[model samples]
Target: DQQVKQNSPSLSVQEGRISILNCDYTNSMFDYFLWYKKYPAEGPTFLISISSIKDKNEDGRFTVFLNKSAKHLSLHIVPSQPGDSAVYFCAASDWGYQKVTFGTGTKLQVIP
Candidate 1:
């Protein structure tokens, strides 16, 4: 069973608009949430993260939110740009366990 899921396989947005990516998880034990961005033929790079203790974390134009009660999390990118286009993966893990579960990435395309 897939513990983490990104229902939307792809998303498209215009440049300078806000883009929202959603993720859901079945595991309640997850204490840390991470978002990664991957470009063609390259490894995924860590983007933003949030801990269970906090509902939100922001870095630059990227923000991550965790809803423990709903086992859901989302990443928001404001004024999305073409360079921000990539396959975004939502990952979750229990800090102590050190094992991470990743959702099938959602491909985001920004139109300039």
Candidate 2:
């Protein structure tokens, strides 16, 4: 069973528009959540993260909201730019667990 899931495989948004990506997790043990943006072959870079104790976290153009009760999370990018086009992965981890469960990933296309 997939511990994490990104329902949409891809998403397209116009530049300066809002781009939203969704993810879901099945495990209640997960406490730490993270969002990573990847370009091509490079490894995923951490974008934003939030502990289960909080419901929302934001950084510049990116914002992540977590709903523990629903086991869902979302990443929102405001004023999306062409450079924002890339793949986004949602990951979850339990305290003291070295391994992180990652979603399949959502490819975001920000059209200029």
List the lowest-lDDT window of 10 residues for candidate 1.
Answer: 63-72
Backbone clash pairs for candidate 1 read none
TM-score of 2: 0.97
Tell me the spans in candidate 2 whose CA falls farther than 4 Å from its real position: none
Residues 1-112, candidate 2, lDDT per residue (tens digit)? 9999999999999999999999999999999999999999899999999999999999999999999999999999998999999999999999687579999999999998
Clashing pairs in 2: none
- Choose the strongest candidate by TM-score: 1
Question: Relative to the unseen true structure, what is the C-alpha lDDT of residue 9 in candidate 2, on a scale of 0 to 100?
Answer: 99
TM-score of 1: 0.98
lDDT, residue 29, model 1: 88
For every model shown, the clashing-pair count is 0, 0
